[model samples]
Target: MTNKPMVSIVCTSYNHGDYIAEAIDSFLMQKTNFEFEILIYDDASTDQSPRVIKQYENNYPSLIKPIYQTQNQYSKGVRVEMFNHNRASGKYIAVCEGDDYWTDPYKLQKQVDYMERHPACSMTVHAADRVLSDKKKVLSRVRPEERNAIFSVERVIEGGGDLIATNSMVYSKEKVKVLAPFYLNAVVGDYPLVILAALHGTVDYLDENMSAYRVGVKGSWTERELATSLKRINHYHDMEKMFDEINEYTEYRYNSALEKAKLGYRFSLLLEQGRFREAKHGEYRKIYLELGAKKRVLLEMKRYFPNVTESIRKARWKLIH
Candidate 1:
């Protein structure tokens, strides 16, 4: 292996013992014309993830470099990606969380070739299949609408959560270095990173499905069930903070879209807790008005006679089904 690698694959794990091996093996299976290094960080996993990481590190000494943490830095608000990113000597960085794995062997080769040919494209993401961990069933395919299209910063922000898939993303390391504190400190990583990447250059989409995103797994950030009102509120708070940070970092360039997202989350929180009257006031009033007369009437019905509206909804659902 050369001192300078062509791509750096960064994998973060916390209690992903059962799925770490598959993640490692997937990287090992990549067929590329250039050299790449796998930087796997085990964030003080309470499970057997450390042992699995050790096994791979021992077998593939040159390619797999494992960083076993004694204390979980993520809980302390440490950005593991920053550390892995500093150690990366590659021109491109590919991300795949421990619970997720790549399905195609040519994933790296294709991405690298695309980046080389299109220097203006700061990042490239492909389609991925969402799989439920419990039943091992493929739930859905996630990707943007236009295949092989170049997405501008405004377009990416407008696309919202559908712009790119985290595991399917491979971005230019040089462009990624321009990411601000707003992105590094955000609750979630991928969306902000994509936005930051778009600020530097356009982001491209590849139509190929090359990875599996495992959801509904224990300790999985995106998959865990928010079972309480408090938990749901906390989730929205985090999302709101993320949008606020993005707005500030981008110097209010996408203010309108950001405001819409922030208000959308606030409205969802109010609707979840049955605070309909409060939702009709303040910044949320605009969003409430956008709900149309039918939804507004339904909201009033839900506020005054929740049980009746719920019954009607259930009956309607049953009839439709």
Candidate 2:
């Protein structure tokens, strides 16, 4: 057999000292017939994350390759994943952030088998369980709407909200490398990668839950404590910019879906800050006008009766949960 690995597991880390070991251990525990290498990029963490990664590298010299940075690259507008991407020497690439861990030992093997059988599929993603870090509660079990489903580019674009778990994603490295410039300029990483893979070929969704996506972890990007109204607005604007880039690249093939996503984020921001009147006057005015009569009436109620609206919101949340 050749010395080269068949799959390269690329993990990116910052200050995830507490969780980094679990992520690395999960990769090490994966039982696959073919060889795979773990390429971890540490962005000058100020915690014990580097130490934990060093232990793994020392233990598995042949399987684990690590890059320790002296300066924080993300703050300098560098794409850390691209660094990992360039170093990967495998036909397939599997991504698992340092805060998350694979639950199934067969996760990599299963995805590889599926990709091997379906030559037309550029990517394969499995289901994952989302857990809250502090409470150690499973927030929700996320999966595709259908099992063993083949998703087209249009379909993938339409199912916009967390359709594919990043930790559960495995894609063709050859196809991913040829993605348009928009992918490199994207505000967020995973969504654009999914879109690029879909654009190349079909995407497969396996229903098996194989990974754990920890939310609200300290120093993690998805932490709720780090999100403020202003930050949310800025994030939405960045998303809008990414959509514009994608629209230009795809020649407006998925403009309808992109427009819906843009409108959704704008509306969400408006609702978050209780800016109902502003929503009725800006570029989002068309979206406001397009809202169903019942929804429009609800917004009008929110504007006129803020206290009542807050009470109703709490009640609705209580009912849902």
Candidate 3:
């Protein structure tokens, strides 16, 4: 009787036919003695995704179990589908969506070992490399910023670790069950789960880049609109609204507001670019003013004093680029 931890790998696929096989192959290569079951949920894919799932299930019946849906659940929502599929399992959940793949065969083993040793650790996340679709190879290793390697919530928040990479996280069954209710309505489903896990127990940073996240060129959540101010402003506003719903501390709100302000500053570039309508520009200006009070004193000072803002902006430009 093997006493290894049972790891349930959940792979959710929509239209990622091109990437699904490699996703499954990553799991199939796992060298662990633990009972690992791969649950592949095809979310009513119209592409070759169904065929890919069938192929993998046929090849590795011992490790793979494919769940097929007959109709489009797009209206019912992706989050709902994910929660339902995940709730059925009682073991620890390690997520690697069809678009991403685990690179290290010992990824599960390493995490499980750590969690067992450190009973306080609820979740463990490693770093991941980003790959382009056409290239079919890694474009660049998306290394974690110096901050995430350490385990501090403030550092995590300031260093943008709140955007915890989904592929890198390994969730205990208890955490999975706790998060199932919250996952349903969260616009950005992953954030609340991370926050909830942090509340319950510590989330460890595994420092190594052990996974590959395929960044599709035409995906809905790509960073292509970095050049567009209105888009940036809207994105920040959406994040601000999401943050408001968290019932977290004022410090959280303060940090979130600062982030919103920085985004608004970038968004101001659109006004400079003459891309905004007069009314829209006025609204944008109002947003910056509202965010100004919540941000740092320096930013508020910059609001009242343009010459100082210009000098600081020039210094920032020189330093950053």
Candidate 4:
């Protein structure tokens, strides 16, 4: 009899007391035949997050195992996702951040069932609802079109970081043991993980929206990164470097796609720095035309009405994030 857990839930939290309970409860509610363990890592949260985790751990000691850090490791250059992933003891790893929760009680069951039947699939992901930090007003889903399909390594590479939502990811534990140096040193976590999975095996996409991703949470990684122009541009630079590294690592196999993604980032960098002329010309022309009407209008506003554009951006950031 195999006694190991079928799935290990690696959940990371940082001062997410307000929403951590829902995340834990969602794990507790999963209806699956195989055993699953929830590994919650609270990185020295000052909020009630640690307390809430302790309460749940006491109630479900057998299922809920938590690591409560006295000091935040993320701020000290720790790969928080890898830290939690290494401690997990299961055949499969399911990542749902502290701020996000599963909507389907059978989410794990469904993903595991598909993976078991398709051994070549290293990772499985599905559509997920992107909600406001308040947990109301869903913004969108990870897969807006909502169709089941298989994604190849090339496709995943071209899709970029937001290709798959963090909350909706369930991947095989075996494939990640031997990884590239670039993957370990990536500034962003999920993108490399997805690419690594695709390199080894196909990524299966389930159309169901089984999880919720809370966007624009205060102090959250995305919210903080998008807070300022310099930060946003720096974030894009990191992404460009990651893409270049991936290009070299893949030996230019996916160069065409990777280059396209990098071009998009370069265009964004130009826009952030108010280089509208450069952004609208040359190789950047295609991506600019691909932007939606609203986005094009915003770009035009940035060129013609700088003050008005800044005001609208600030208002939108406050309302959305």
- Which candidate has the top score in lDDT? 4
lDDT accuracy of residue 257 in candidate 3: 41
RMSD over all Cα atoms, model 3: 8.6
Worst 10 residues of 2 by lDDT: 220-229
Error of 1 at 150 (Å): 1.8
Estimate every model's Cα lDDT from 0 to 1: 0.85, 0.85, 0.65, 0.88
- Any residue pairs clashing in model 1, and if so which? none
Deviation in Å, model 1, residue 225 alpha carbon: 8.6
Top model number, TM-score: 4
Q: Each model's TM-score, in the order given?
A: 0.85, 0.86, 0.71, 0.96
> 1-321, model 3: which lDDT tens digit per residue?
243338888877777787888888898898885777888887788889999899888888766788888875654655643643454453577888787888899999898888888777777888888776646567676555544453554434333423467788887777545553433545555555665566567878887888887765443243344424466566555555545554343335446543644455445555444444441455466654554555535554554675786687667534432
- By TM-score, rank the candidates, best first: 4, 2, 1, 3
Off by over 4 Å in 2: 224-226, 277-321
Better of 2 and 3 by TM-score: 2
lDDT of 3: 0.65
lDDT tens digits by residue: candidate 2, 1-321: 468898999999999898999999999999999999999999999999999999999999999999999999888888788988998999999999998999999999999999999898899998899987635479888787656788888777656648778999899998777757888887678988888999987788998999998876766774332246577778877888888998999999899888877777887788768877788887788778888899999888888897898788667544433
Question: In candidate 4, which residue ranges exceed 4 Å CA deviation?
Answer: none
Of the candidates numbered 1 and 4, which has the greater lDDT value? 4
